[model samples]
Target: MTATLIVIGHGMVGHRLVDALRELDRDRRWRVVVLGEEREPAYDRVRLSAYLGGRSRAELSLVAPEFAADPRIDVRSGTPAVHVDRRARTVRTADGDVLRYDALVLATGSRPFVPPVPGRELGNCFVQRTLEDADALRAAVRPGRPAVVVGGGLLGLEAAQGLQLLGMQPHLVEAAPHLMPAQLDVEAAHILQHGADRLGLHLHCGTTVTAVHAGPHGAARSVTLSDGTVLDTDLVVFAAGVRPRDDLPVAPALRLGDRGGYLTDVLCRTSDAHVWAVGECAAVLGRCHGLVAPGYRMAQSVARQLTGRPSEPLDAMDTSTELKLLGVHVATFGRTPGEDGSAIEMTFREGVSRYAKVFLRRDTGALLGGILAGETGSRADLAARVGRPPATDLERVLFPDPSF
Candidate 1:
């Protein structure tokens, strides 16, 4: 008898788990059911902004062509899991169907945060997260119209660039003091700010959006900043942040983090042994890492255990991220600043062409973390050195010998 397993999401991380299980579970010991809330199957959400750059829906799809054809896999798109009967090990769907499962995996991912400001519900106000959100933003863009994008992080910067590509006058609003504050140091952020200015993006840092004003026609007209400046805009896009989608029925029974993600053990198991959680919805060791890499590792760990393979605990994870925002290359691998006080920090810069910083153990010279801006060509090589002691001549790597 094959065990029944139900997965509550079909996003990138969820699909990873399914693919891993399918590859390793050659015995066909388990039957899988995937329930996706979106009508469309999983797609490359990381490249969602590319849609504005002429990429189509089909190009962003992450679903394999043979996935739906698998006899052991049952994919129900547009179906959302509404409630979980933990006692009965069953889930109730939106269509009044109850699914019994020997094991349950919650991969619900997250929802983009829209601030509760006045006039937020007005027309042309959007949040960038899913393909649907991207479509809405694309339709809302009016060439030569003014637009304000909330937040200066990666997503917000990407939105601003996308808006610019659509021929809109894009302005970035960041409550923090600098762009990519969490990833880049003050100096690195300064370089990025310069790049944004070159791209013709308006920057409004250190101010929060207090409220959005709407016109009599119910469309967004302007936004009021905390600094008492009113930015006149035809549209507003909020890329502020995201919170895990933990509103399902199973949410109440699971232990959640202070910030609202399902608390799971290293094995990705919730309080219930039969129930597991992964991706953005899961918080391991009380910390929820929103990056895709960590989420992908979590999916692999859970899949290994379910397939009766040697499962290792999710111990240390690399939270590094390398990407180009607004066409400006940026990479933050390892911790920006080492937590230990005994770390030596080095910096290098050259005429806006590059900015690099490295942190090493003061005594052992082990690489801790680093940041690169405008020059990420060595991102892959440097990122691989994180958490490991430097094996090569560190001086030559940061500053190549003139003789060589």
Candidate 2:
């Protein structure tokens, strides 16, 4: 029997599943229908901030024409899934139509988190999730305008830099004591802070926005800081973070995970055998991975299962991170140095800013955590260095022969 596969939200993971399905079959037994809530094609959400800076809309596309016209795939745009009826194996659309599916996959993805504070409802205020948001942000940041971005995390900084390119004096505000508290240690964050400061970007660490007051026309006029200072600005971006989107109603057949995600088993299958959930909307093996790589893996897993092939369980992944910041390479991984580690080796060249440090369990040869700055040219190599054995020899493993 031909399987009717319905995938919701054609973002990163949704698109990957479409690709995996095409690879599995040349025949037409499997029917793939993708419902994209957005009005346009699936573009890279990871690069949306770069789009605000200078990248064209076209550069963000993942699956272009040839993939779109595939015989087995039918993509429906501007269609939002309002509710899911699990027992009946049907999904209701905002247009009041119901579509039946033999197997359903929910890849609704996450949305930028905007905390409720005064003036948050202003017209010019925004979050950078869709292309429309990017367009509005670019318009708000006109020549010589001032802007403040709440949250100094990766996306927050990226959005801040975008405004900088548009001739805006960008101020980054973070409630945390250091930038990227979830990703970087205090020392590494200091290096990033210094670098950003050198770029003339004003950073307000350990502060919060008390209110955003707007002009009578409803555009953001100025942001009032918690410390009783107000910065006059035109653009106000909120890039605090993203959480799985699950506000819509779901059919009883779809089992939502603990704390609101769609629950999926090792194979990415939901409570019902015929239904599966992946991407930001899923809680896999007790952890929610936001990066694209793991979501891509889940897409591959489901395709293999449908094609009657062998696939591996989505195993535990280290919640580490590495990304470009104003052209600097910043990476963080493993445990923090002070926690559960016996000894920590810190290396720094005084004149130069290169830094490397690693922690080893006091009694054993196991690797606890490590951080690399400056010579971060080896961020990937260092992250991959954590494995079953204590690095063969910490220094030797840190710097291996390039020839090997």
| Per-prediction CA RMSD (Å) | 2.1, 3.0
Best by TM-score: 1
Look at candidate 1 and tell me the lDDT of residue 279: 94
Instruction: Please identify model 2 stretches exceeding 4 Å from their true place.
Output: 26-28, 333-338, 341-352, 359-364, 388-404
lDDT of 1 by residue, 29-131 (tens): 9899999999988888888778876799999998787887889999899999999988889999999999999999999999998888888899999998888
lDDT per residue as tens, model 2, 194-245: 7787778889888888888888788888998877778888868998988887
**What local lDDT score does residue 215 receive in model 1, on the 0 to 100 scale?**
84
Q: What is the lDDT of residue 278 in candidate 2?
A: 86
Kindly give the stretch of ten consecutive residues in candidate 1 with the minimal lDDT sum.
Answer: 393-402
lDDT values, one for every candidate: 0.86, 0.78
Top-lDDT candidate index: 1
TM-scores for every candidate against the unseen true structure: 0.95, 0.90
Backbone clash count for every predicted candidate, in the order shown? 0, 2
lDDT of 2: 0.78
Q: How many pairs in model 2 have backbone atoms within 3 A of each other, for residues 3 or more apart or on separate chains, i.e. clashes? A: 2
